[model samples]
Target chain A: MSLDAATKPHEQLAEYLATDMEAVNRMIRARMASEHAPRIPEVTAHLVEAGGKRLRPMLTLAAARLCGYDGPYHVHLASTVEFIHTATLLHDDVVDESDQRRGRPTANLLWDNTSSVLVGDYLFARSFQLMVETGSLRVLDILANAAATIAEGEVLQLTAARNLETTEEIYLKVVRGKTAALFSAATEVGGVIAGADEAVVKALFDYGDALGISFQIVDDLLDYAGTEATGKDIGDDFREGKLTLPVIRAVAAADPSEREFWTRTFGKGRIAEGDLETALALFAKYDTLEATRRDAVLWADRAKAALDAVPEHDLRQMLADLADYVVARLR
Target chain B: MSLDAATKPHEQLAEYLATDMEAVNRMIRARMASEHAPRIPEVTAHLVEAGGKRLRPMLTLAAARLCGYDGPYHVHLASTVEFIHTATLLHDDVVDESDQRRGRPTANLLWDNTSSVLVGDYLFARSFQLMVETGSLRVLDILANAAATIAEGEVLQLTAARNLETTEEIYLKVVRGKTAALFSAATEVGGVIAGADEAVVKALFDYGDALGISFQIVDDLLDYAGTEATGKDIGDDFREGKLTLPVIRAVAAADPSEREFWTRTFGKGRIAEGDLETALALFAKYDTLEATRRDAVLWADRAKAALDAVPEHDLRQMLADLADYVVARLR
Candidate 1:
């Protein structure tokens, strides 16, 4: 439980919130069981038990604890956040036709799409039930809005995929919808449940929002940079014709032949061998990856700055480090 | 609008609650819209406005009105109910790989499975938002549990599909989860939002549960009986190897040779061209379809009897008739 600097910031946060994290895991296991449908737990267990960082739930716990609140409902809120995250991953794999997730076969691959869809739904309902147990109307409202934003961002991403017309503004909106919305909600609900003041809650929300944006941008950059840590094949997003920030920027600066290259590969979904190399080459040519990297760093800085309003605590320092760690992955 | 016996009871209820129903429709249209993701409304509108009977939402409206509680939030509740239904239908079509819904091309078919899945999630989130606006934690709890049941039933059905050993009890569980859960929740939440007594809420729950069971049973019967009124091709469920009530009973009464037939067609999913006719012949031989019809009638009767606990109102009488009318399709 020592604060080892060599270890990841998330690992440090996990150590700091070790007791609450255990409670959250226990609640997740207890609630995921079904009286009649064994398949519900089977699909759920595959993803939930997979060695995820458990980063989102820890945000909830850290936010609540940092606000000087000592309550049992923080565990419930953390479990609720994790359930929502797991449910989305199950559905995302199905929508993306992904074969692998968290370095293991996806639920859709291990089980059928039907099980994944239905089981994801079961988890969503479970999450709703958990939040309702808190009896906080404000928490329900925040999480409900977060759910809508996440779904809307996903749909927007689907429609915006491979379109050369996608702008950076749209990319930010998509990022907020798909990633930041939940992050912000996860942190905001924790503060709300702890009865934190408006200023402190707003600070928590800002921190989460900036951190999530940085996290996603770094993820998008790594898709081209080829990182083994993410367990994603390099340029998988390119193969899928997803218009992430780097590609959107590269397309923005493309010349005639480059535009056609972008159109043939991304817009028309006619990716061929070495398309990844060509995409990377274009990124290098336009320095779009660097620009994207700068964007991630800027967001990370903002996340750290947001914590200045919060009371000084060990968790607060680790959270600021967490934002840095997210962008530091690009190094 | 007159409660003409010649007219269907749902239609009568629709006419009786026209004003409220219109408001529900307007709210559905408004809430389904997305400024960023036009695809959300497109996929949603295809199914939402495709001339559905709006039976689920109408049940909510009728139940609230019958409870003698006048409130603006009932419109919101009815819309919430429909959004949940539409969202499930979108995902169900994707899970079933269905081409047609409400006798038109499914959204999954027109768009891709991705659109269907994401748009369905959007609708579910939208439904959650609508319910939160009602600010009734009791209603949220009822709907949350119902959501869990619906999802659990679907998972149970997915696991039990094509299994010859799936008993009547298991079949009932599947039916309750996939169909009756929503139906009961619709009525129960209506009574709950009206602040009705526990007895009245329980009665509403009972009425909805029985009506949904009978409705599903009759629908299964028509899959064998081939009624154009239901907008489903006879033997569709058989072709899909679904273990509906008729198939479950037929298998229970099946002899050795009949069991082998059931095993090959259903269990192994080796359905051939003549299998539908053979299955129908077996159903006739054992009078299993007749038995299923009797079960449907019994459930319809139970639904009508449950109405006796409620006050004598016109909506109550119409609800009773609605129960009978569900089974009337079989005749």
Candidate 2:
């Protein structure tokens, strides 16, 4: 890990983009409201007010500034990205039957699944409105496709859950759809709005995509390693019977007995007491955790490599550092 | 009524727009598919292939044709509108926890709630993508707002479901959001896409808005009238404790004894045998069912009146007849 990343590059980027962040937040508050349906705003406020790192929208602001955009629409684009992210989170909570998010009761838990689903739909519709206001068909195209890809990725993950046949290729596709698609679109739209050259836009997209891939891989690895600040329960992926990267790798390398263990736990949903510890031990013995960490670092390196085409600037440097920081927790 | 109007105007409209309806159907099939998530196509096909009338998309097609649109993009607009409607129905079934739709098992029943929610989201995203391909920001804006309104109306309905105090004004608002908003937007976008005159566009919007309101009111009334062809079960709203127009009217005029009955059935949810029949008796005493039917006729009249400014085309005549046919069953 880089020495400077120890100081938290994400917070640094947030600080640097505070003004634009405020604008995005204002736009979010303004657009999430429905004059007739007070429940829409109430449910949305419950989630949007919960403090998660506004990383995706920050990526958009930073990318736009780095691309020399001085226009007013980047804020709209950033808010649009955040709205899409928030909508997905609302639906995810309902799908996961989750009760807590960002250390607070989830919208689905505070309200019912009906409110969560309907409000999520409202936010998605609002997000499309915000993006359309940008008046860039190219921007709309990129964001719309990203929205579809995110849903596709989630559905794929749904079918892949607890299925031992899920491959690394399929995992990558899911990751690209669920996480990186929005990340890449956030950055790509930023550059596209700035009228940046195609190469620069492509570079920003690749950097965001690789960085997002790295971020998700690190998150998956941390779920097994017991990180307190991961905002996720340790071994959650295990308990949920999700066949994430480390577990998938461990299953691939398992002997017949170990394969039977995985089948009982994930495939058959027979998770018992101490089974998580046993699974952790298998992850250790197979070095699958380390393998997953190595994959994260590789993706982080690719993220940095993608930035080589962009003009060397402080924002670009911060973006590169942000990629490093995503994996820095492993250190 | 016109002599030919004794037949279903919806079928006549479908026959008139058969070629365009085929195009819309092709787009629906093509766009509902996902290469990675086969489950999406599976669920969507169950609904799309069902023999329900393609009414909303037909509105878009008929409006565009009546406005002298000869372009190919109206088909895209029509397809987009249908996708939005289908997506909402999928989510609505999950929200309502219904076991059947269009005389078949609901998607939620056959697949699950999670698939229905996520697949509904996919269709919404797909609808946005389809609209954006037309390269019309006006269309995007209209459709996006309509989508938001649909969600808003649904949330409003959720909060107002069992409350006896739900006024006629609020019921109308819910109806506007849930039904009329999309209908108006579908027709509005068709005219906007064809570069129709402002008066013609406004006329089309008003026509669709009134027609949708009329359509929903009829559906609500038919639930009490014992119509087998309503495709909705008799007393289903009463069973679910939904306060539709008839109930709202009865509640408004309820004497103390009638109010107590409503409180027992709807407010407290302590429905017993013969409760629905008793509710029907109250509806008859207050004349709320007949009053609701009158409201439907009023809206239908307004719908036909709004078409006065539209060009005198065969499709326009069919649309006017369609409004009449919406209330024809009440006779």
Error of 2 at A123 (Å): 0.5
DockQ for all models: 0.65, 0.65
Clashing pairs in 1: none
Candidate 1 residues A1-331, lDDT tens each?
Answer: 2234578899889999999999999999999999899998888898889879999999999999999889889888999999989989988988877322333477787877788788888999999999999999899999999999999999998889878899999999999999999999999988999999999999999999999999999988888885687667787788778899889988989999999999999999898888888888999999999999999999999999999988789999899989988987787
Instruction: Supply the TM-score for candidate 2.
Output: 0.96
The lDDT values for all models are: 0.89, 0.89
- Score every model by TM-score: 0.96, 0.96
- Indicate the residue-level lDDT of B164 in model 1: 84
Q: Which stretches of candidate 2 lie over 4 Å from their true place?
A: A1-7, A98-104, A229-231, B2-7, B98-104
Give per-residue lDDT, candidate 2, residue A245.
92
